[model samples]
Target: MSRQASRRARSIALFLVVTMVASCGTLPRSGPNKREIFAGSVLQEGDAFVVSVNPRVTAATAVVPALGFSSVFRDAGELGADTIRPGDTLGLIIYENVEDGLLTSTGASASLIDEVQVDSSGFIFIPYAGRLRAADSTPEQLRRLITRRLDEQTPDPQVVVRRLAGDGATVSIVGGAGAQGVYPIERPTRTLSAMIAAAGGFSIAPEIALVTVTRGNRSETAYLSDLYKNPHMDIALRNGDRIFIEEDTRAFTVLGATGTQNRLEFETETLSAIEALAQVGGLNANVANPTGVFVFRNEPEEIARAVMGRDDLIGTQRLVYVLDLTRPNGMFDARDFVIRDGDTVYVTEAPIVGWNRSVAAIFGSLGQVTAAGSAVGIN
Candidate 1:
């Protein structure tokens, strides 16, 4: 080939390489590289507070939303099944020593009152005893009061009061329980766990099952397994309490150069950063940068103070935690780092990947240039 043709071809190839290198930033990439991420950090006058993963950082951000019962639930003592309420039915039997007494008939010394319904005012009426307050009194207490009232006319009157199951204290169990119904607060099912067992345990896996109890104006939620582990969570249930058992809906999003890019549900009650990565099939071996793995989250003021070692922050702070698995303790820090709900785990592409893509573009353009020069009889 002539010198002029060779020089022209060399110039064309050099220009193609320069163009490709200049436009390398526009190459298709999963996300920003490590340098780009650091460039847009708070240290670089950016809004996001970029932190490197360490033991202290892991511990500071290890806070998870806890579930438990308050004093209203834990301190509220169990209700007695025998305590007469406004809606209870009392079975009464009146016996007199004389054959033809006030309450008894001829030859019959006992008179049976099959059903005595207590009114909404908590009063029950007998034939000769008149209206009497039956609520707030036990069966034995009601028996003594009735005997005293009937003893005025009948000789040696004996009164027997039995409390039968009626519209008394009850709780409604629903959502993810083996059986959903309203169960009375009996002696065996007065507490929270006992009532759950009465309705037939949780229908979902205990690991992800959540039980929420709503009493009056307040409600609290706790993991089903936590009730067994923490004694205080198994509180005493109250009347009109509503229980709902459901699966945990907390999840995190995975993106960039990982094995998969999707939203994943928490597999356990508490999830770690490493386990979250594994759930998405881990980092992509071909293109992932081991030093550029990042978890993006919005931390509250308290957590932001602990993590940034500063307290001047206000409102929710945007945070980006960089995890360098190449470090000796990086894997350990990741194992201890808590992956909270709504977190975004992103893996940047390797540095070499961009250069490789640029090089491939330049060479492919050079090959076409070389073939065109040969067709024009320049080579």
Candidate 2:
């Protein structure tokens, strides 16, 4: 071997070694990463933006804070207990002694008046008794008034005032109910639940429904499922009140390396990140980067200000939250993170390993196809 040949061989070997090392894998470059939203500091200590809820999803039921509905209907109205209102019909009966002509035509006979409705003026008319105030008076109070007005015609008259159930307090229910239209409340103190039940409950599971109660000019809304947990939401219903139930319009989207990807309806009012992930078929273990799970949302101004300490928010705005499931505490932290409506949950792809497998599979398929074709040749 000559010196020239030895030198050339050494250079060629060195070049091959360098190429193999380069082809193995390149260093991760420093640049803007995927799913990066500027103005968000990396989730760390002292950052208020990443607010983590402390409760885990031990069960299917999740906690949802009432949105301006809790304080409004927490207590029942005192007026509807026994008070009568106009448009209500009363069944009346009169009793008097047979010997006392001043009081009697017959013994313990019912009033000829089948039923009397309180007029718009809040007055009911009797045969001997002139118009008497019925509205704002209890059945007992109206009974006393009716007997007292007939004192001149009868002696110690006994009277009964019964509310006509057919014409009593009623509520009109529409949407998401088993039965729709107006339903009469049998009693004055019928609750929200009773009225809904009277109208035939909800069409879908109450777990994912919202109830809107409108009483005259005032109206309020609450999650139907939460009513079971919070009784105050089941407030008493009044005459002419309107109740409606419908499936929740709020939902979040899931995409990227998750087992299932779609805009999923929340069967619950609210859910945390871990719970949301579970609901959407969880992370795709084969391709998901355990350290790159993220939730993108437009947080309300108050939350952004309180949690992120940012003042330049125009109502609700976008925010990016990153969760690293590679660490033991990552899932626990995600469990405590609340996912709001319109949120996007994304699990990014793991880079080098995933690409290597994909490339190998493509090459392996090509080699196998070529070998198979070579096996059969023209004779």
Best by lDDT: 1
Q: How many backbone clashes does candidate 2 have?
A: 3
Q: Tens digits of per-residue lDDT for model 2 on 62-120?
A: 32455535455666563455567777877877776445444345453444455688888
Top candidate by TM-score = 1
How far out, in Å, is residue 349 in model 2?
A: 0.6
The Cα error of candidate 2 at residue 12, in Å, is 17
Error of 1 at 97 (Å): 2.5
Worst 10 residues of 2 by lDDT: 52-61
Worst 10 residues of 1 by lDDT: 20-29
Candidates' TM-scores?
Answer: 0.93, 0.72
Query: Runs in model 1 with CA error above 4 Å?
Result: 1-7, 372-378
Q: For model 1, what is the alpha-carbon lDDT of residue 267? A: 81
Give the per-residue Cα lDDT of candidate 1 at 49.
91
Clashes of each: 0, 3
